[model samples]
Target: MKILKLEIKQKPFDDILSGKKYFERREIKPSNVIDYVSFIVDGKEYEKEEDVPEGDSEVMVKAKSYDRLKLVTGEYKGKRPYLMVEVKDAHVEFLYDENGDFIVGVEKGKEYAIAHIVFELGNVVEIFKGEK
Candidate 1:
């Protein structure tokens, strides 16, 4: 499995840490083979890999999940994933963005099928406080 090193903003980072945000949305999807995504604060970097934590401190999830979301408009349809993911073990159905032009969210009461890949994350994993 490939590892993706991402730099995220402070607010999103805080949301992840606080459990307010479960998924990280992106315009471009990462490779399906990625099983671990290591995140660093927008301007921070880690020098040693060994310093990263393991086990319960991290949240394990599927790497990639695909779905087709029915748009609010009955005449149109949108692709799912909008890069949605569940944080830790929490269960979240779908994500919606009012500004999005495509599929914004799932249809009122319909069930949508989703696909998933294997991945893991945590509060602190080999975090190095420095510019990337």
Candidate 2:
């Protein structure tokens, strides 16, 4: 089977990050905005390679001109806050094996900042950028 991919357009972090601040007011919708995962700590660079926590919180994912997708939040025993992205498919193969257990591997791919969302630009090949 062929793999589905997405692409994130190049834009400044301010433009992308601004979309999240108003997701609940129905000001955002899914269209073609870039998706990324990121966190702010002590005014320093916090990479997604770190672990996240488990919780019933919402993670806002905004596209440049699309509706923002609210995602489920999770946590880990280690440092850093973790956010989960909503995937359209249930591809079990995309998951990761953490010490003999299966876990949603959102950060398994490349690392890029799309619309303030932290993700690898390479993993998102066709979905956002479209197929060739």
By TM-score, the best candidate is 1
TM-score of 1: 0.28
- lDDT per prediction? 0.34, 0.27
Report the C-alpha lDDT of model 2 over 1-132, residue by residue, as the tens digit. 322223222332222333432211111112212123233343433334243334554433222222223222223234322122232322102223557543432333633222222322111111121122
lDDT of 1 by residue, 25-125 (tens): 44322332232323233333333334345534533223232221111111123421111222332122233447643333233554322323222333332
In candidate 2, stretches whose alpha carbon ends up further than 4 angstroms from where it belongs are 1-35, 49-132
Give the Å error, residue 118, model 1. Answer: 13
Show the lowest summed lDDT stretch of 10 residues, model 1: 67-76
Backbone clashes counted, model 2 = 28
